[model samples]
Target: MASVEKVGNIEPMPKIYPIGGGKGGVGKSFVAASLGALLARHGRTVALIDLDLGASNLHTFLGMPAPKDGLNRFLNKHAQTLDSTAAPTPVTNLFLISSSTCSMEIANLFYAQKIKLINAIKKLPFDYVLIDLGAGTNFNTLDFFLTSNKGVFVCTPEPTSIENTFRFIKAVYLRKIKQLIKRHDFDAQAKAAVLDTASNALTSRDIMDIVATYDPEKERFFKACIGRFQFKLILNQFRKNADAGLGKKIETVCNRHFYSPFEFLGGVAFDERVIDSIYAKKLYVKNYPATASTMELEQIAELLANGQPASSLLQPAL
Candidate 1:
């Protein structure tokens, strides 16, 4: 279920996972950095692309000064390819494509430019590619999260964070359904049905009903395609007092509501030492390898590397 690209010759598909949540301060960057380091420690060459745009700070979490070259160079055409901007990290097999040096307006990418960048990302050569996306339901953020079927959403165990995360999920899921409709070349009426009508926002069931109304045969195809998306959820900043099963409950609810399956990939406990490591510019997992957060992250990393649940059938063949 891996995606393949042909750049000069056939290239293996790196398992691309875009980490995102609707709201900031949920530890998305930290999760990306930790997962990349853990995967690299286990011998996978990983590329961590910070797509946090204007507020990029993944470099700080990784304990490295911002790399001189990054997405800015690639987007500005100063660099030939996205791969050229990958800077080595302290970890042996991990690389980072920092967005810290990008201009203030970097987040507002033109549609064509956004597509070009997404295509370039698909062609990146690595065993795994983890994208740290900015927080929002903007087109850029949603599109980046859809870059791969294996998107990991992070959220704290709070009402606002969880609510925003759900919004993020719905936005991405809707965008993906629309993409599938376009990619599969659904009929004119089917396409028009999904178009926003001021009063009613389209839901997954609504889209499926429209497809079924247009072509019952295509409905099956559409459901099958949607089912292939395997999204994973992570509860960040978890505490002993919070519901221990909140992540699992959310996963069950999401799986029940959405067409795609959701997997609860455990939680990373809140630890003050994490802040200490960040202030000191050190990788938390490396500095506190025995902490509960580190252990849970390792488990999540292992699942990501070894699990074979599903992958998107609609991701453009780069």
Candidate 2:
């Protein structure tokens, strides 16, 4: 948890948004960069940390070369603090903590290092901290995403991407349930239910059943802790031919089945020019403001900034 000193009263912690999905090539980095830029444009201090580990490339999206000082320096103890590794981006009010400087073995961070990094991230002084996670549901990725309940999952409209996204969501949800059980010292039955022989075979309902039977108070506490999670989903590379209501439909399904609230923050229209913008080393939202994809991104950025749903703006674009 983030700790704050009191000047007169406790200061509000930065709103951390970990952008991740189960698969790569889903525009996770693009969305993170665009959202960071948009939020900074709104006069909020934003820090974009590339937690992509072995596959870091977020700096390119911001039209800047990789920075020499980044997470690697802090992780290696060369930097005293994680914030010390932060390098300013070309965008005003935006900072970048690239992982490009990390060694090849950096992806497999040790347990101690991971915990230290997580705690340091929480201490970063910024209005908004956006972490661009690498692909997959690895323990590290899932833990990073869970560092804040306000995770933004990005996926495309393709069946495979959507399937991977669902898998990612399940992994994250299960991880949180296990943490709660351990934290509150649930009975052996509850632990067994969660750690069945088969991998990820137990659902939230199954564990909750065991937990409720063991202790109703713990069950309620677990439910409340899970319920407090506010997850947001975004669809990328959306084409007109694809189902426009797909995001909302997924959101509905997740809400009905899971304990946490899931909000679909609309889709970014597919545009080939995004590739062109990338090749030219330019920020798409900055150079192509009038494009369909950019406009959609802007709307998503606004919704994130306001931290509320604008039903009219959230309606699927036809």
Which residue segments of model 2 deviate by more than 4 Å? Answer: 1-12, 192-200, 308-318
What lDDT tens digits, residue by residue, belong to model 2 across residues 1-318?
Answer: 222111123333788999999999999999999999988988999999999989999999998998987988898899999888989988999999999989988899987888888877877899899999999989899888977879999999999999999889888878888776665567777677666768457866677787888666688778888898899999999999999889999999999988889999989998998899899999888988777787788788888889664465456456
Per-residue CA lDDT of model 1 for 163-239, tens digit only, reads 99988988887787777776666878888778656526777667878889986778887788768778999999999
The reply for model 1, stretches above 4 Å from the true place, is: 1-12, 196-200, 308-318
State each model's CA lDDT, in order.
0.86, 0.86
Indicate which candidate wins on TM-score.
2
Query: lDDT value for candidate 1?
Result: 0.86
Superposing all C-alpha atoms, what RMSD in Å does each candidate have to the true structure?
A: 6.8, 3.8
lDDT of 2 at 74: 90
